[model samples]
Target: MRIFLIVALLLSVSFVAGCSRRADDRAPGGRVIVSYWEKWTGFELDAMQRVADDFNRSQDRIEVRILPVSQIDVKLMLATAGGNPPDLAGLWTFSVPDFAEKGALTPIDAALQRAGIGRERFIPVFWDLCSHRGFQWAIPVAPAALALHYNRALFREAGLDPDRPPRSLAELESMNEKLTLVELTRTGRVVRLPYAQLTPAEQRSHAFMIVRAGHLPQEPGWWLDLMGVWFGGSLFDGRRITADAPGNLAAFQWFRDITAKYGIENLRNYGATGGNFASPQNPFLSGRVAMELQGPWMHNFIGKYAPDLDWGVAPFPAADPAAGKDTTLVESDVLVIPRGARHPAEAFAFLAYLCQREPAEKLALGQRKFTALRETSPSFFAAHPNPHIREFVRLASSPNAHAAPRLCIWRECQEELRVAAGNALWGMATPEAALAQVQERVAWRWDRMQARWERVAEARRKEWLDRELP
Candidate 1:
């Protein structure tokens, strides 16, 4: 199946390139036409087009033609390999490492320096997302930070103060217990349990914090860096793999214990009741669940579907309050110039314009997303759709904010961790045993990837030497 997909991708790229070449020859005004592929749809697409239209009107030397594409990352890879890629693309931050290592992307350091866009202008975590292995590959446009969103009405119902959120793991757990209600059938079987009923995304976020609190070892080359940083751990120690570090084992065990305490079956039953996340029937909106971990986008859903819902947003509590205060996981959609772009300089010019304060804020507000910039004007905060925008911006600029594990195999590693977590949660394997399997599998994959890259480097070196000496 993978091979078939690869072949299909290459064929599509060839076809598209032919079409693009013809289109370029007929473009108006002899202006440098930069083709940009983005992954946004509907309103988001409109927002981006507004920015593009403004950029075009601002200068006549260059024109950015925005094209919305599905599965953009795959298409990007195929196009770049075929030697005909988009002038610029908007990609998930996690895709940077893979694209950079594959030689499909152009480093943006020189372009950024020429534009006088210093790293200090960006939120620290968002700025870090642009680089991999010491090379800047992309620039962040819309960044997000995770926070705890709780129903104020639920808090009052549980006899808890609506204003004071949990400050530590113990407090959060206690609040969860109080907010949770158990309903039973006539046969005494459990029917509903609110606290344990979380989406997979929420569950993963919780797992990350648990692992971090367990004091996981710093040098382990594990996949779960969002959790690792809290414990002062990194996913890699140079090129060495440390998947089976002592801290990771402890973290997995902790996760297993928490899962067991909640009763997996009950959690599963409650989770099955959830409706579409963006719909009116959403667990949080419908009052089926009292609390959730979500981004600012949730506000849009709430306002659209349940305007009367009383909710408050607060910083996600840490396992240890003193250690994890203000720490956040930052994610973003980034812009990059592909390797074979015909208008690299002009493409970068548009990128630089988008990164400016006004355009950045405009796009962010359009999507209800936070700006990647470190500072914003007072008007931005006041007019933002999200009432909690200030809190999110604060977290974005926090000293401890971090991006996810920046590795080429991050997606693969995340899948492995999910499987291991499932095994432990279902009691099919002991936490220690499940994590042991993860360590073995991930280490092997990492080693294999390293070998492949090394071989590529060697082949390139030999080819250069032979050509020069001959």
Candidate 2:
């Protein structure tokens, strides 16, 4: 029935999408073809392919073909809605809730139990990332956690000890000021001055610009919305929206204060000088910015762009370092069997295989990442590409480590917070006012969504718990 529905829509979907299709039941060699759609490209994609090759070699029953697909989330949702989703897909763990809410995923609670896959097999944080509501929707393939990536060379240049990183946000802020350099350039000619040397009048003048910054809260600010995680607030408390929580207010105020410390116009001009994040011209790589919150994958880019960079990784300072000790943002890449898949059992067989100690370690190694499993082989660190991989692994296992909240409307809430952050950070509005508005709007949306979910909650719980690999 699902295949018939897919064929019915093929002409139009194909006309629009080049008709990307799921694999048939059998390959040329008569093995099951598990169509695994993925979003990774370049070396990252190659890593997953090698894992798939290993799985294929390990079994004669299934041939897992990993296909690189663009806009995979959008295409995946559509394909599942149209009843033709691939056997498996690679998605960010945050997407699990949204997909599950749409009835586009197969909950694998029974399959997991049958295969002896459980929370004990993986790090608790990675396991949690793949779960939504009361069901396990996916399995983590690779995990990541954010940390303070600082240039030791910049520290030495600023007369700070290279071995020591800021222990508190206040310390970080002080060091940021010391490392910052202001420029008084007119007509594109050059004059460099320390920010301290600028007169009060000059500080506010458009003529004076930030030539180098120690940190800009918005630079490479991928998790600006989740900044509250470090500040001891969360967007949701499982029942109500917490956008205007005191910690979140402080989080945004920190943004406002940071922006004010460096003049807004100066920071704006500094932004203009920013270069591509992946290239050598990246402010951090170029040594114009001294510190950033980044993950282990940064080492790969560092090697590709700035091999000589003297850098160190440590837990990013928190507002209250003692209370928020070891706090970090945990994120992961996950694999899922989309609803209406052609080969659910065989596809999951491949997923289960990858979750094993050996293959999980191999995939993580190939991607220059650490595995979701808690106990890593000693050789994993010995042969690891990044020398600081263990630090990331430690961060992920911290008591305060958090993944995105499992809300069906998280993307909407995230965008609202992003807008609020911009408004407060850029001085468009006071942090309190900006966040109050966000709270009002997102709460209304969340209430409506919760009401709808409440109506279907019972049925979903029954279905999600009872479904197995069909």
Per-residue alpha-carbon lDDT of candidate 1 for residues 279-357, written as tens digits (9 for 90 to 100):
8877778776776667788898899899999999888676657877876667899998887677778888998998899
Those runs of model 1 whose alpha carbons end farther than 4 Å from true positions after fitting are 1-22, 185-234, 241-251, 455-470
Please name the candidate that would achieve the greatest TM-score relative to the true structure: 2
User: Which model scores highest in lDDT?
Assistant: 2
Q: What is the lDDT of residue 267 in candidate 1?
A: 58
Residues 276-357, candidate 2: write the lDDT tens digits.
9999999999998999999999999999999999999999999999999988999899999998887889988988998898
User: Candidate 2: which stretches are off by over 4 Å?
Assistant: 1-23, 185-191, 196-207
lDDT (CA) for every model shown?
0.73, 0.88
TM-score of 2: 0.93
